[model samples]
Target: MRLVTQQRALALTDRTSSRLASLQTLRSQIEHSGNLSPAAFKNQAEILLAFFPEIESIEWAPKIKSGSLDSFERRLQQTQAKTTQLTLSDSESSGIAFHLPIEYQHRHKHLPLQHPPGFDLIREAQWRDAIRSAIDRNMITSTRRYLAFAEDHPTDLIRLFLPVFQADTSQNQLRGLLSLELNVKRFIEQATQSNLAQAVPFEVYDNEDHNKIPLYHWPPAEIFSGLDSPLEHKTVVLPFADHEWTLVNVATPAFIQKYQNRLPIWLFVASLLCTIAVYVIVRITQSLAERLHEESNDRCWQLEQSNKALSNKMIEKGTFENALRESQDRLHDFIRISDDYFWELDTNHHFTYVSKQIVQFTGFPPTAMIGSSFLDMLHEEDSNSFRQALEKAIPKKRKIAIELRCKGHHNHWRWEKINVRPMFSTEGHCIGFRGISQDITDTKDELELLPETEPLLANESYGSAQQAINSVADQITSDRRFAQKLENFIHRHKATLDKTREAFFREALPEVAHELAALHEDAAEIGADKISELAGELKESHYKQAHREEQERLIEQLESHLEPMMDNINQSLHRQNPGSAGQKQA
Candidate 1:
């Protein structure tokens, strides 16, 4: 029972240590990306907080220079739609050189807490000391217990400060502090919430400061009132961040009564029975002595046979080792000579190994790529497809081949074809993946350009459409009302086509297509063959792939044709009525 209780205490310690280490993920993200918007920070913080229920909140306090404070406050006011000031309490406090204000905070849904923007963290002594230690050492540091305000009241919370540094600066200047606030009592309860924990009450204390009270205690001390000392006590040291916590497990009187041992009573009863059986066994041994002597001589022959078998096994082991060495050598040689770079991913899809050839292809050395997530290298649009493909292949232990766009050096995107097989342990559990990626950017571009039939048809149709528009302008030159309407029609659609390719593709193209179809019917009703033919041709042209650069080029060409038509209409209007044209121009 004592052994079981000690093991549980050690397990809880390790669990807490691992949870603290996981906070580095958030710290690394802030360092790599620099400043994160409130929305982006909240999204990431919520993800991490979901895995750790003990964490009450995550806050980001950026290191605002004195010169930038006004601008920072102005930005916060605009975002929050309220007056925000960088507030500092106890301005007379000594050893306070700078102040950092909280800019973003994400708390648990159950905890209705609000650490509004511009709330300075440097006001508190403990938090200020922790922030200084984190920045100076460039490591994560923890503050002693502090009271954090919630909507209704205050709660005791311990905070960890992780320093973030500027990624692009040569000096590696401090950017901000990322903090995680946790309730130690709740953290311990969640970590040791098992059947064993119910029997073994425990208390956790900060070993660095023995004068301080226990960080968390399982049961109230009142339960042990008027009771005797504990039956057993054990302590386990848990190292996390910058401090050590000792988890002390105690087996009290109640625990002893609940799990009492009966081994002593059973041993005494077995001893008396053994004495009675000894006399009868002494008489029986004399008759078996001669038979045992004959069997001992036969055992010598069997031992000789076993020695020969052991010699045969040793020879087999040497041959197996030689074969294993040759296999590994061949694998290394293949990776060295291959033009396509090789990579290995752990079960979480993080890169564990990359060949030196990676530098030639992606312009990133093996060291830079290692330990980074494979999904981070992929383009946003392609990440989902790769994940879906991997999910389907993993269950069946099948190989997957996919083409994806990967972000290379300087943020340039390149298409790559990846062929990978899932690696498995001897027990048939999936361990990771080994793969080779070949650059296929040129091949993909060629395939996109292969469809020339549609472009040729489009060119012929656009030529006819341009000529028809010009012919309509000449025929309607004499009628002022008709010319005015034609001019308005051209300008309205031209304005719609002038937008960015992405905007036109997603929003303007559909409306323009519908209007052109209407124009085709109007021209046919007015008995204008040329105008009707042009509208019909345009309405029939395919514009499904609006995201393509080719679509943007087409819009530009159409606008060029409209420019000439607009010029011709203006000239015709001037020739038709010199007096009216001059008055309108004036």
Candidate 2:
């Protein structure tokens, strides 16, 4: 009977082994097929490993004699068949299938059929339908493998339950019931380094045909190893119809309590000494740890102080940067207001900081002006002097002034005076230079206003002669109002002459006055018409006339408009720079 039970255990193991091999095949195929990611395959592989450790705890029938068979029979029952199946997921509600019989389920099969293409899903592609059918068949095949073992053995129960408890397309209820979890709490509770144990699960399949059978477990732990010593055991029982079969759990003995030989008095004393040494070591370690903790805290404090100092330095640097920016902005505003430009030059004579006023000065951006020498804007004749001043400034570290007419950019001829002064670092070492250029065109214009040098002396004598004639005419005007006396005086002188006593023919003056008034009106009208006509011609000919012709016309107009002004100016000059007053003083 024992031999037969051993054979039965081997058979159950073979069935499970075959199923595991087939699962491996499925995993390999899924991997090489390139349909799943490496991570996904690894996750699925881990799930399979989770299922594997359960197999180690499986129990087989114990030793039995000819009479033991009857004892076992009395304990169990014959022909009490254990029926089990696997349920697989599909496009429709999955079905449960058996591989061999209802009594054993250690062997599982592949997947089963998918539902007919989702009514609408079919019309789209026949290929998808075929793929669905293939996957479904694989699942159904997996289901059958578990059924074979369940049909034969009563002990192989997980194969029967897990398929349904964790069936494909399972609801939450099945997942909770068939969780298949082992309560490792026992291993944790009654545990010591000397006594190690692991909680294991047992499942029972009650077959209707009560055939007494054995089952196999692999990769046995120390408790399960019959060769290992000092075994402790626990039993779990489930009642069948008219019989109850038991499952045995085993463990290792406590290593510390299991004494193999007697110890000498000296050895016992040495063991105690070792224990005291360990306690001393522990105390020293604790003291060292406390000291290390204190040192770490002190280091943290020092680091915090240094960090604060660094942060303050950063803030101070930021403030100084802002102040420098404000100063630069103010300097730029001053240059702009004065129609001036400034720049800095390194010893290599490249502009380091070109001011924005350069745009107004040269019609080019400051960026364009940088990297150019100060001589770049100088007139050809003044370049030598500008270079000389730059060289002189470098040695003396003094301000050097240069005057030059910059070439007209955008038709603007600006008279600029460059003032270059050497710059130095705080150590009084030559760093570079700063130079400001001012537009001095107005100064030049003021210089040109020396009226005493305008060559008016050549016209002075003619002006004096004309003034003499004008004085003589003024004297005649005062004496010219003598018409009333002139007529009588002329008559008396003629009468005194007594020669031509004939009546002086006195013609009527009335007709003559009216004719003279009519002549004056005609002359005024002619003059007014001529002035209007000339003004129209001048307006039409504007800009089209030759420059010389325009100038001539302007001169003629100026003579006409400024004759009175010239006379007034001459009178003022006569008062201020008066020749007669000087002559009288002489």
Candidate 3:
């Protein structure tokens, strides 16, 4: 009985795997053809249906851009091909950007179009997921159970979508989709048609992450009756695109009953022979015990070797920790040489700590700078503005940068730029400011000579350009009021607008006006801010532009040093030079 059951299981598995593999091969053939014409689509479906009769219908649902739909529809009409007219209702087309129009749908062994030519496949929820899966995975994907196409037969159906990419755009753009609808009930019947398979009942389930949900079962009613342990039976994993399905074949009640009825007679005959074999069994047991004792001794030697390996691993762990410490030391050395020095402040805006690099620029000891109020170091006029900015910035936790003149140890003022961000405590209370300050005295001196270094555009051209942009912005703002009046006029005289629309282009003028109004609104939305920004850029004097450029150059120089510090430390610890693979390895 065991031998017979194993043979039946193998037969069921072979049939199911072979069918799916053949369908996959057909998909490859269609995809490689380079052109997805209606004829090519229908031809492939016809061939698949011959081998896998369980497929109830096949469809070629091509995705069309909204801009191309009207022209594509007109081209179809010109061809004079047999088709049904399917237009979306006003509400259905709203807010949809693309349409999956069914170009060809064949069903029931015939090439008849089952749906209207342009019926949207994406409207159905299940088909929408199947479409998404195909595009996301770029492979054939199957949908969960959905209602069957035939109204009278309420059987569950599974749809699979294989994406077709356009040759011109290659894999980046999807040209269309090829889909198949399988009747689940018919699929089971076709799979288990053999007499051997029918003798034992089985079930097929979609195994998503090892969670089994019955796709089809024998005796049909067993599905609703529920399964306690589908995995307890003889289980097999049927691989599908991006998922696996579980196939379980079990012994039927009749097969079990027949086996039980023959079991008792065989047991009775075995009992009668048991006394005759007792002396022979004792001799065999003594030989087995001697073999077990030899194996136990071998296991003790293996355990002793494992202990030596553990001791070697501990030595390697110590070596790794030593290397880690060396890398950290190199990181601190890099930070010490950086020009931009770090500073931290208390909640009262008094410096709590400053890096030693600050002494190089200020000529003040690090200890002397500690506990000094940040505002007191700035020039008096700049200090008042800086304090007001910080007062507003703290509550909002805003990032800020300010220029100030600080007194050095020689009693000379040096220009500096400080960038700071508000820090917070674990409980979200305002803690203090943490920031980096860089000396910019040399940069400020060079920038002050910029007007003599570089020539500027003539004031005539710059001033006129600024005035022109500002004028256009004001005109657009005023035109928007007239646009509203045009809409109101059209709404108040709909009949007149409709008559004028038909007289001009056989379409409603009011509709045209509304579309034009939408276009105007879009123009206003885009033009206003863009013109204002242009005016500001044009009005920026030569001095302001030069000053901005100088600041950006200084920032780039500072970042160049900071960007590679960690990478340099890693290379140093690992004993590598630049332009070598060590930088790449890190």
Candidate 4:
């Protein structure tokens, strides 16, 4: 019972430690980069919080020197569009002489609305101490339990602080601090959600505090009160990030009754009955003892000879078992640390085993993949090929290697190289397959980018360009207002040209020529050679009045080519940077 309680405490402690380590890694990365923008920091925090539900919020407070405080405040006000000030309370809670202020924060949706920026850290003793310790020791630190201000009310929360230091700075100059706030109740629940925890009611107390307040009480006091006195109680000390917690676990009445051992009582009764029978047998066999003694001695000698032979056989069997176990262990270790993932499939093609490394390439845990059909993870186009290959190889008990596309994270298709050999039973009958899978997605992408594959590369580029042109065409066709405005401009220009040819040539002719020349250059750049030629002809015809009818034809040709030329330019821009093309168009 004590062992079970201790295991639970250790499990919770490990979880806390793992999250803190991840936070420390994040801080180190930011420190090395020497810059932490709010958007980038917030993005990282959100990702961490998504994976670790125990964390409630992540806050980053950059260090601000006294000389730059005013400038920092002005910048903050501009970004937030409000009057912002860094507020410091009269009390000096933090041991440090200087105070730190909160700047940017990312929080879970369950948390209440965040307070405006410029929150002074020295206002709270717990947060202040955590920050001071992190900076002084150059290590991560955790705050004592405290009430956090929420929109409706205050909530109990604990915070961890990791100080960020400036890269290549003397004395390891402080750059900022990253803090994660965790809901105590939620953290406790997530840590002890196993079935064993349900049967064992537990309470966690903070040993660091003088009063020894309870941090969490499992199976709330109300429910615990209705249950009978526990059969046994166990205590465990859990250490986490500079704080010690005492965990007390008690077996529920139902659990005690279900698992209580009665072997001792049964053994005593059995011994007494055997003793009475022995006495009766002794009296009855007293006369026969002399006769049987001689026969017993001979039988004992024969049994001893047989026992010697059995012991030798047992030793050989033990040696074989130990050797096999060691070999299996070595194989598992290799699979765990290798870049590729090892896997096994049953005769039905369902996964029977998968290494933990699979998570790196597939974004899925081993437990989630087990028992799932291997073919289900393959791309539809590659599924049939893989199945056919397996079928042909399995019958011959031969090794098979194939490259196929598999569904990966976010349902994205990734190329994988798999090599497998069929497993056989003692009788040499095929039973299953063992394989290793390597993620070759990057390799495949690199090959596609190689200049040697001109035909494939050209087709991909052409497809992307065509898609971008179609997107522009759809937008233009849907915008009726733009079409109406262009029609108005053309009508007014034609009227002016017909009313007074001499005046039009003197005033509008130069402006038209300039616009045509600009269009000609733009068209040439986008590979619209036909549009460029038409525009150049129109520009040259502007200087000659003899080709009046020819000028009208040139204008019609330019108008017809203008829409396609614009589409081509839009496609060219999209090809340069597909991500921001929509934003550029807007």
* Best candidate (score: lDDT): 4
**Every model's TM-score:** 0.39, 0.25, 0.37, 0.39
Clashes of each: 0, 50, 0, 0
Task: Give lDDT: candidate 1, residue 487.
Answer: 49
Candidate 4: misplaced stretches above 4 Å? 74-105, 109-116, 149-154, 195-198, 222-232, 252-586
* Alpha-carbon runs more than 4 Å astray in model 3: 1-24, 31-36, 70-105, 109-117, 149-151, 167-171, 195-198, 208-213, 220-226, 229-232, 251-255, 258-586
Give RMSD (Å) of candidate 2 vs. truth.
33.4
Give stretches of model 2 more than 4 Å off: 1-293, 299-303, 306-321, 324-338, 344-376, 397-399, 408-415, 422-433, 444-586
Off by over 4 Å in 1: 70-103, 108-117, 149-154, 195-198, 221-231, 262-586
The residue pairs found clashing in candidate 4 are: none
Per-candidate alpha-carbon RMSD to the true structure: 35.9, 33.4, 35.4, 41.4
Residue 209 lDDT in model 4? 67
Model 1 Cα lDDT, one tens digit per residue, 1-586: 3444454455465555555555665665666554477676777667667766678767676665655566766776567633212222223433323333334344445553344565555767777888779878988888877666666676667888877788778996767667777887677666555423245566777765546567776676533311133456766677767887776666677656764575344334433433333333333333333333343334444656677778778878888888999999998899888889989999899999999998977788999989999999899999999888887767545577899999887888999999998888988778989999999999989878886664322245335544544555566765657866654554444443333233453545555676667656654554545555655555454454434454444545544554555555555556666686566556
lDDT for each of the candidates? 0.63, 0.40, 0.56, 0.65
